[model samples]
Target: MEIEVVVPGGATIGEAPTWVAAEAALYWIDIKRPALYRLDPATGAQRSWPMPSDIGAFALTADPPGAVVALRTGLFRLDFASDKLDRLAPPPFDPKLFRFNEGACDINGRFWIGVMFDPLTEASPPLKSSMHSFTLAGGLRPEPDAAELHNGMAWSADNEIFYLSHSQRQAIFAYEFDPAAGRLGAPRLFASVPKDDGLPDGAAIDDLGGYWCALHGGGRLRRYKPSGAVDCDIALPVSQPTMCAFGGADLEDLYVTSASDQLMPEQRRREPLAGALLKLRPGVSGLARSYLVR
Candidate 1:
């Protein structure tokens, strides 16, 4: 339950931490810098690839043999070796008005991403954001929800439930998911985190059906029981813990990403570890991630 800095990275806003077990590496994105970063835990080696535009999130594909990145303009398959980016599909909304925020793969290998208003510093207009579903074959499809600042993206152990967080709303929702049909039922109010605890951000589901979510700007990570009761809350050094994923060979190590963006000069001086990659052992194994099959 003790979290420590594993990588002293200075990402403007590090989000979308994904554990690529096949490569034995953790991948995350810096939203403002518009870059993709990789860190090898064993060797303490790190590298980065500059993105063509602001990349909010991405998915690792097995079929296409590269990263499926969600940029401000559209989704593309990025080839680092050749510096080639092939457009997979355009965003459902105009890039100037909205951008992808956080995403993850579903049980059936479909990529689910949430859109948010551009320039998150100001209040956003209603109906400007949405959740989109994509597949390598079908391209992009929009869901029924309109979210302002969508962040957390996670699925249940049985693949029967879907969890997503609305940061502005300070709430997380649960949907009856049909993996076979790739459909989501009406969302049910799952949990509304306390305001002082910080807004709900990235999340991960455990084998015990517990939901572990990072509290952005709260300097804490919390685990919610199945009944929506608080089970655990661990303090973190960074105030803006963006996202987290279970990594390591056994999938027990929880790797978290933080941000240094939007901090006051005095605040930055007080928290020097604001944008570092964090590692911790939660003593519970994570549910296997749904990989992109197409």
Candidate 2:
């Protein structure tokens, strides 16, 4: 599988790219700058939206013509057509202690979002952040357990398994997922990379049921089997590859997003493509795109 560069030169921290099949567009977020972008491959057209606060996660709703965003305060709706933003949930308790990070849509159209530990409260022991799931049923619940820095999240093809990452810890976890009940089982350590290796950020599942994850600081994207074995490694030009997803009509074009926000001056100088988006052509196709609950 050969990897190519796409949107080749700009992104501070690109994460969570969702494919909107109907419109043939890819929607992704840049957490550092807190902006949203829609890229149309056909015309190479890219449009961006500024967020009042950092966006942790968001997804395109299946019924409605907009996406749901998990913001610093709470959840809200972003109407792409009208370019309007509306609040969906009130600010959570301890609003200042947490902010949104990674988000994705599940098989049931629920949006799962992660929160980053507040930097202001460093003296406090590292708190275990939770992965929150929003259902069309209209309620928010912590899926199962808490993570130090919950990042990438995705479900298996049958929707029975879930994968999550703790970025700073350099580990990924797997759990049995029950979509109907919106519940998860106890997590077992999935895999961990050495400190010198890149940290796992965002990931997506392919049609073959394998998961492909971008190693944020590691400069590569790695694929894994359900058993947690490394199947393949695809290197990238950037060191901060944040997320990757399969888009394009055939679902074979692998689009990856990277970042530059936390790079040291020296590292940035060495890797000018640090924040650029990348594209790869893999041997396997990806699963169909999931939609968010309206």
Candidate 3:
């Protein structure tokens, strides 16, 4: 399916584009610039929230219910109706060790927020990160292992497995998941992508159980089946395709978000379209909307 660049917002580092079905809108975050954006595909109306720090990623929560955001420090639930934010978990016990990264919600509607070594410090260099998960009732739980640059969070259609990408290694890993217990098993390689384009950053699952991944450096979006096979590739004009999701009324439209934070001066000039939101009508459709746990 062909993808098109729609919202030319020119985000510095756009990641985690998610569809809020009930609102008929797409939500995403610009990490480096630290902003939250809400976009209406139908009307092209965009609203934004200025954040104090770079927001790693976010998901909808249940319980007292709101949007859960992964900040560089810790996890917080945002009361959208009241425009308030409350910390759910303190930053990693070892503040110097890790910071929040990319993540998404599980099929059960619980928010999963991962972490990586802090990139701002000399010891916490890029790509040296780890992944984690958070549940409203259970709190935060660390994954067995982590990555240098963790990203591209997702879950399978059946919710039996979870998928995440390591930008530093240029690999996507699939973990056997237990939805009822909210546990992850040993991870198996889902895909091995080339580093020249970029590592996988964010992803989404389709009804077919295949994963659509954003190649952060690859300047493209790729589809991989549960068997770890490449299904198709949708190349983009930009270099840093950070994340993507299936949106629109029918869930057949593919929306991609990109970034320009790491581009050199000359490269940035050449790829001015980097960091814009793009869209396309892929023939394949997505699954039913997964509401944010309230």
Candidate 4:
């Protein structure tokens, strides 16, 4: 597989690459820069919307034809055409202590979001964080488990399993998912990275049940089988790859987002593609992304 640079500029913390099949465009966020970006690969035209606060994740919505965004302040609905934002719900915890991080929509159209302690602003951040499920009618519902830093959030093609990563722990976990009930069973260790390999950041599930995960400090993307075995690993040009998603017409193109935040000047120079958006043909098709039901 050959990797190519799609977007060349550096983003502070590029993450949550979501492909909109309807528009044949890609949407992603720069967390620290606190902006939402949309890119049209065909035309090479990109657009951005300034966010009021740090944005963790967002899911395309079908009903209102916009996006449901998870920002540090709370969950909000953003009108893509008008650039209007309407608050959906407030953050479950105090925003000062915790902020939303990773999220995605399930097959049922319920948005699942993860919260993490903000170490950048808080002098002494706590290790505890939580995940929540949101719907237009049901609102936000917190999960029973906790983690240090929640990153990867995805569901199996069958919707019978959910995958998440605890970056601080360098582990990715799998849980039996009750999609009908929107509940999670006890987590089982799905995969782990050695200290030198780097922390598992964000991930996506392919149609064949392969979990493609981005290794932050390791500068690689690893595909893990559903049985928790490694199948393939691809080296990346940037050291801090934040997330990956499957796009392109057939959902065969893998787009990886990287981060340059908090890197020393010399370190940034060494990793020239540190915050670039990269694309590669992974030779596998991905499942269609579920949109928010609201």
Lowest lDDT sum, 10 consecutive residues, model 4, at 118-127
Ranking by TM-score: 4, 1, 2, 3
Better of 3 and 4 by lDDT: 4
Could you tell me the TM-score of candidate 1? 0.95
Measured on C-alpha atoms, candidate 2 has an lDDT of: 0.80
Choose the strongest candidate by lDDT: 4
- Provide the overall lDDT of each model, using Cα atoms, as 2-decimal numbers: 0.85, 0.80, 0.76, 0.87
Clashing pairs in 2: 56-100, 56-101, 198-218
Worst 10 residues of 2 by lDDT: 118-127
**Residue 261 in model 3: shift from native, Å?**
0.5
Error of 3 at 171 (Å): 1.7
Off by over 4 Å in 4: 120-122
**Candidate 2: regions farther than 4 A off:** 120-125
lDDT of 2 by residue, 1-294 (tens): 566666765677788887777788888888768888888978889998888887878877654577787888788888878878988886453566778788777777777788777654455776776778786568576766577678768888888888899887899988888888767877889888777878888998999888899887888889998788899888788888889888888898889998888788998888888878788888789987676673
* TM-score of model number 4: 0.96
- Measured with C-alpha atoms, the lDDT of residue 157 in candidate 3 is 73
Which lDDT tens digits does candidate 3 get at residues 49-98?
77777788888654554578888767778876676888888775355556
Candidate 4, residues 119-201, lDDT tens digits: the string is 55646746686788888898888888787689888888888888989888888899999998888998899988788988899
